[model samples]
Target chain A: MLEIRNLTASVGGNQVLNGINLSIQAGTVHAIMGPNGSGKSTLSNVLAGHPQYIVDGGEVLFDGVDLLAMPPEERARAGIFLCFQHPVEVPGVRMDHFMRAGYNAIHKSHDEEELDPIQFDRILKDKAKIVEIDPLLLKRNVNEGFSGGEKKRNEILQMAMLEPKLSILDEPDSGLDVDSLRIVAEGINQLRSPDKAVLLITHYQRILNYVVPDVVNVLINGRIVRSGGKELAAEIEANGYEGQGEALQPSA
Target chain B: MTTPDSLAQSEYKYGFVTDIEEETAPRGLTEDTIRWISAKKNEPEFMLEWRLRAFKHFMTLVENHQEPKWANVHYPPIDFENGVYYAAPKTNPASLEDVDAEILSTYEKLGIPLEEQKRLAGVAVDAVFDSVSVATTFKETLGKQGIIFGSFADAVQEHPDLVKKYLGSVVPYTDNFYAALNAAVFSDGSFCYIPKGVRCPLELSTYFRINAAESGQFERTLLIADEGSYVSYLEGCSAPMRDTNQLHAAVVELVAMENAEIKYSTIQNWYPGDENGVGGIFNFVTKRAKAAGNNSKISWTQVETGSAITWKYPSVLLQGDNSIGEFYSVALTRGYQQADTGTKMTHIGANSRSKIISKGISAGHGSNTYRGLVKIMPKAANARNFTQCDSLLIGDQCGAHTVPYVEVQNSSAHLEHEAFTSKVSEEQLFYCRQRGMSSEDANSLIINGFCKEVFQQLPFEFAVEATRLLEVSLEGSVG
Candidate 1:
């Protein structure tokens, strides 16, 4: 469902994602793990069409469409959802209102009927249970004065609302506690289906225990150096990627 | 949507005028013109004496005015003597049914259908054309509620006791140059009075339109919410395009009695001139509201998107214990328009509180500034204030400035002020684009998001209207 060919990106004239190439098919889950400043976040930001990231080379295609040519909102409407590491605090924009806007934007693009407040409330209430989020929080300003765990769960709630074709969880487990991690994992598991893809971007192995990926790719210095099955994640958890010289430059 | 080039060539939607205009004083600012206006309005002896005093003060203030160069706005010198001090619609019927159809049609063309606007605005409307109130709607219904809603001229004659007591009590004759001028030659504006303990059922609305050339619009609005009463008032303005700058000096005074609440909202869309700044209204307004009794509240919400040079500061005087004041504004200036607007919150009572939220957007070489003041007097112990001013600059050529003055004399008073100025980043735009939005849509979304805080303070209907106005005003320029 997604393909990246020799993606080289920079931010403020500094190279961040260098010569990165990856591919993932529908109904598959891929985990990209790397240390801080190793371009893990940069890769997610570039894929989500962040403006600050300058794409110097290569192209990205989603479902055979030129992904790079679309704006961030268009990309979102095209079913590409990015769970921000740190969700933006949009003051005065109620959570339900923001979710409705996102849902309508995507639904309109997909030629689906828009949900009114009543219908949306029913759907959002059910999804709220999956993420263990308080329904009352949905009525307040988006992410305003929310705890770290609440913000991460709100991100998952938004992801569920959009129901994107490709969901990129960029360190969704960063500020979550054990309970929140379980709730987030349960939310992702419920969202998993035969027609959707998930890209789990993380640096720790704790989240893998709940939502294990079908494939694991080790990213270092902008490039994915290793690609293997679920066992690869277990192996990396036992022994970090410090001494895997041969796997450092694995074939894309 | 029309292309930028087409819109630029299109004539203003409200460029027409009624031909039935009759009475008009000769263009000039002198004792004779002031006397003519006072006499035409049939003012009392004391009122005429007040006008003469104000006219004398206006002459002195104008000489030392110095044009207030500090504001980032420039306009051609206004010929005080060349402006018609008073121009009432030719036919003045005593009732709405007697109002001229042609003049009413002009209002209909302006999108303020008199009867419908009267219902939507809630309070009686004293619609002003050029320099006079053409018609007032819903006066009887409001009068039945024991609320005095009518034109200032009518109030001066009918409720002389209240008018003489409250007029100029908050803002004296020498308050400012514009206030002085308004006090001198002000033709007509709305006068509202809410009886004690009565929650006004309707929103009072006043529509001001400048239809004549070189005619100054000096309007005076007075709203008094009696003790324990509550009221909300709205004012809107627009004008025709003209080569020569037109002076618009209006004074609005609001008094909230003990436990009363007064909300004043203004959406000023005066003629802002073309990109080259050829012709526009020089809007110099003085609006002041006073919390006259304990626990009274006053709030001001304004969406200013027009005028070549707008210099106005709607202020609040907290004179009662635990009084509260709030100001929410979104000022947008584009294409040679300059706006230096904000509010002043004066805390003079114990435990008084004030909040000021100002959002400014500048594009197309326009200059927008937020100049606000928060003063906590020595007696205002335990006073609290929070001020947030944010500016969004669209193009590199435009400028956004923040000048906040805070004075806290009581050591127990707590004051916090924060401001931020930044151009929308390309990164944020790209992020939205990647989500499948057009560049224009993304810019609009971000701008709207930036203004969400202040917009939320508006009434639900006005919020939607303000958002649409912002979108239309920023169209074709959002990159």
Candidate 2:
């Protein structure tokens, strides 16, 4: 469902992603585990077409469309979603209003009829239940003063609403309690389908236990260093990132 | 949908000039000019004397005052002697039926329903044409309830005591250059009085339009809410597009007595100049409210979207113990428009509190400034004031500024101020875009979130109108 070749990007003149290559097919879970500052988040941002990250060299294709040339919104309309690690606090903006606008926008771009507030609210409430989100949180400002777990759950709720073809979960398990980790893992498991693909970006093997991965890739210094199966995550967890040959490279 | 080029060429919606027979005073400001206007309104001796006093002070200031260069705006020097002080429709009649057909149609074109049957439900409108108010709707019903609402000229003739007592009480003629000018040759505006313990049932509104060419519209509004009474008043202004700048200096005085509350809102959409800044209205207005008795409250909410150079500060004087004052403003300057607007809160009594929320958006080479003042006097023990000013710049060419002055004489006074300036972050825009929203919609969404506090203060209908107004003003502004 997604293809990346020679993906190189930079932020503020500093190259973050250095000619990385990856490909993911439908109905598969791919995990990219890396240490801190290993360009893990940069990959997610580059895929979403963040303005700050200048594409130095690369090509991306999503379901036969030129993903690299499209803006972030067009990419989203084409069924690409990224669950942010730290969702911005849009104070005074209600979660319901934001989500409804987003949902309507996605549908509108596809020439589909949009949902009214009442219609959208019912769907949102149902999706909230799937993600175990408090209905009250939907009434509050988006991500304002929310607990860490609530934020992660909110991202899951967005993913469920968007129903994207390819979902990039950027460190979705970070800062989550053990109980919240279970809830989050359950939400992701239920969202999986034959036509969908999920890319799990994390630094820990804790979530792999809940939503087992079909492929485990180790990324260090902006390049994929190792690729294996689900046991690879457990191996890295058991021996740490340094269990294999130098998991991190010294700065040039 | 608007492109950058199309936005620059977009026509002003309310720009058509009305051709009605006119009665105009000569283009000059002298003792005779003030006297002529007073006589035209058939004012009493005291009212005429008040005009003479203000005219003398204005002349003195005109000699030395340099138009208060502190404002973040620049315009050609105004020739006070070149503008006709008063211009009324040629045939002055006794009732709305006798008014000129062109005048009525003009109001219709402006989307302000002057006919009693067609007026917006729950709103009583007083339509001011040029220098005089030709039609005032729902006067009979308002009068039956002992609520005196009509033209300022009518108030001077009928409710002299109420007019004399409250006029200049909040905003005296000597307050500022524009206030003195408005006090001198001010022709006519809306007058509203809510009797004691009576809650005004309708929204008392005034719609001012400048249709006369080469004329200045200086209207004075005085609203007094008696003890235990409540009232909400709204004013809107617009002008025809012209190359020569028309001057509009208006004065509004609001008085809330013990246990009374007054809410004054304004959607000032005067004609901003063309994209090249050729001609528009120089809107310099003075609006002040006085909380005269204990437990009174006065709130001001304004949405300013137009005017080539807008210099106005709607202020409040908390003079009664425990009185409250609040100001909510959203000022947008686009297409060569410049706005320097905010509010002032003066705490004079114990335990008084005030809040100031201002949101400014600058687009299309527009220069917007939020200048505010908060003063707590020595006698105002335990006074509290909270102020927040947020500015959003649409394009790199536009400018946004905040100049806040805070004075706390008493150590017990608590003043909290928060100021934030942002360039409508690319990250926030990307976040919204990644949600499948258009760039323009994303910008509007983020701006609306930023201004949610101020929009909440407006009435339900006006809140929706204000949001749409912001969207229109922001069109094609982002790159």
Model 1, position A13, has a per-residue lDDT of 91
Which prediction has the highest TM-score against the true structure?
A: 2
Residue lDDT tens for model 1, B381-467: 999999999998886777898999988899999999888887777655654454445666656777888888777777677778778
Q: CA lDDT, every prediction?
A: 0.84, 0.89
First chain TM-score, candidate 2: 0.96
Off by over 4 Å in 1: A15-18, A243-245, A248-252, B1-23, B64-72, B116-118, B121-123, B377-382, B407-412, B422-449
lDDT of 2: 0.89
TM-score of chain A of 1: 0.96
Worst 10 residues of 1 chain A by lDDT: A243-252
Per-residue accuracy of model 1 over A1-252 as CA lDDT, tens digit each: 999999999988999888888999999999998878889888888888786778999999999998898767778888899988977665555778767766776777888898899999999999898888889999987678999999888888888877889999999999788998999988998899989999999998889999989999888888788889888888888998786535655553
Expressed as tens digits, the lDDT of each residue in B217-306 for candidate 2 is: 999999999999999898888899999899999999999999999999999888888889899999999999999999999999999988
